[model samples]
Target chain A: MTSGDESRPVTEEELHAHADGLLPDGRRAAVEQYLAAHPEEAARVEGWMRITASLHDTFDEVLDEPVPARLSGLRPPSRLWPRLAAAAALLLAGLAGWWLRGALPGGDAYREAMLPHRAAVAHAVYSPEVRHPVEVGSDQEAHLVAWLSKRLGTTLRVPRLGPLGYDLLGGRLLPGDRGPVAQFMYADPAGKRLTLYVARAESGETGTAFRFSQEGAVGVFYWVDRSMGYALSAELPRAELLRVADAVYAQIEKVPG
Target chain B: MSDRDRIVELIPRLRRYARALSGGRGEADDLVQDTLARAFDKLHLWRPERDLRVWLFSVMHNLHVDQGRARRARPEVPMGGEALLAPASGGPGDVLERQRLIRALEWLPAPQKQVLLLVALEQLSYDEVARALGIPVGTVMSRLSRARATLRALLAGDGRAPTLEVVR
Candidate 1:
């Protein structure tokens, strides 16, 4: 039988079972008696009780907080770009026979600017891998750094992911608008994958801004620091992505330019 | 009432449930906001006859699970900045006790924490929790039993199991 069957130190499952109030009367009574005998364990249970109490104290009040105006019946502002795009789509439908070359002046540049979008799509496709998730494992950090840096013509640092319960699975080089870009993949024990796409910043000042963009089920968080532009794409919730992005930002900040 | 109005009405309960589930005020508010956004977006799918609060809660639970998975992907730098640890006191200590409690909740896996909060704090019926968690009623009971027993042990500071059966 497994160690779980023996039940030496408390298993997380058992802890959960107890907290869930699922134990049989006999087992529950045994646990309670055991706790009564063990003061330390009883204190921990009390702590849990207090936490539940505190949670109620803290948030039950929010029930009375008025819902924000923006959330209730407020419509998000309609940006100009989408309207222009809709108009263009309508116009394009009428001129089906004619090849409208250069219909928009920055059309090519716009397509090129959307490299992060394409990369986001690719990231959503490949990040869910179990075995062959990354082309280079973080074990070869030095090599991975040298290769990606030389290829992208910018210094690259592989962020440490120990705190997030993930280590670098490694990275791979992928094609981009300028040339090859590096995709670093990280995975947690639960097999959730997050991809960090690093490429040379497009011509402009590196803006430190948080921008949210989405396509299909995937979300892309793209930002530029110095001459390097980073895009983190995943199918995870937006808040979680922001947390990962914060970690990536912290690690990237520590690297000397 | 419009679905949006109904959802707006549920926000307070949603915040309370989220706070209980996360074991912290900040994270709980974040969870509630996410749940509200999702519920609003998927309002068409909500059946009017069904309980809106429970439906919002399930969304919040799923969001928490998704967030947990994502956090696992990118580890952050450890903030070891020392805060004062609580002194041994019989009654509820200070803010430190609350912090310790939060940390302990974090130690439990997501499912267990969710189950415990739903039943114990939210006072959700076993049937309500089972439906919210998409698990069987029997599974809900077992999970609640295990969670309560574990919390009892953790709080009691004894590694031994609890002797009291929690009658719902």
Candidate 2:
């Protein structure tokens, strides 16, 4: 038996297993007997242990380095508001909270570069739900818009995509790398999803070139307005998604305050 | 913790493992991104009693295996490409010892190198490694032993593992 108490002649596997501290009590004792008798084999097994220790030293730093936002699909729900407050304070002081941005180069470059990808990741993560998809369903559209607007510190509008074959499916409050963000979900007649990602743009941020990034399976059309960034993401073709984004941008632009 | 929280916590270890398998940071992160996508897509397959960490590791492992099969029949990416050459942490000190150890690892057959890392770096038991890789525990032990022997030979300048290309 693999865990037998009988000190059957130890195999080489048992010796290394001894080095790994992986042997069971019975086999561990037997291997201890073998290693006690054979000094050379004991020394080699010790080397394995040392190698294993140094491997941790070499790689564990990755654990502390911030995970990139591109990989973070959603920040935990409880962490949203506090980070939003901190992000707003940093924004007022003309600093964009570089500490929260991870190792993605410097300043607004991280946001400018990562916005679309983050949106696409969020879309891929949440847009597929048959249940519990939105925190506030469309039945409560006024409350949803007001709550999200309060959290995001801006006026909000849900674009009417009726002409474009998609209808409002409500929205959720999410934690962005820098602050609280909002996602407005829409669905076509066949239940295909499109999400609009909204976050506060840094002060002094200029209007963008209207970038389109294909993040894995999702296509994202994203841009910066005067004080907000927007990314409309979906599995739709580029032209189709662009048309929808243009309509959304136009409606959002109509919000006066 | 929520499954989402646990998943977020495990990203770094997944990246470190990806770095071992595929060397470039871009490639490693891409691998991790892909892994996260797959894990979320297959989240329904996971049982509540199973180890999420191990299950996620297997998701990454199987995803790579499937992607590997698609790209020209290669067993895996060419090892020792670039991640190992960079210092694993802090400033690049002597790094000679670390380099030697990594070089030895790069020389190992992909299977052995994988088993070795799963054991040494991730601290997985043979049984867990077997479960993650879909192999028997006996096979995990044999590959690990072979990996040890090969590492011993390469580190001693014997150049024994045919799979490793000696950079010197």
**lDDT (10s digit) by residue, model 2, range A1-257:** 24446548889878877877788776766777778899988877876776677667666666777887657643343133433443344343222333454534554555566677667766766776544568999999999999998998878878899898998899999898779999999988777899999988766775775789776567899888867899999989999989998998888778785
As a whole number from 0 to 100, the lDDT of residue A183 in candidate 2 is 97
**TM-score of every candidate's chain A:** 0.56, 0.58
* TM-score list, all predictions: 0.40, 0.53
Candidate 1: Cα lDDT at A189: 69
For residues B63-141, could you state the per-residue lDDT of candidate 2 as single tens digits? 7778772232232324543343333443323367566665656556667767888898888888889988889988998
> What's the lDDT for candidate 1?
0.64
lDDT of each: 0.64, 0.73
Q: For candidate 1, write residues B34-80 as lDDT tens digits.
A: 67667766777988777787787788878877888313322121233
Give the per-residue lDDT digits (tens) of candidate 1, residues A8-111.
Answer: 44443444345446554535655665677788776656655555665565445656776553234222111233334443553343233123443343454453
DockQ numbers for every candidate?
A: 0.21, 0.24
Fnat by candidate, in order: 0.40, 0.42
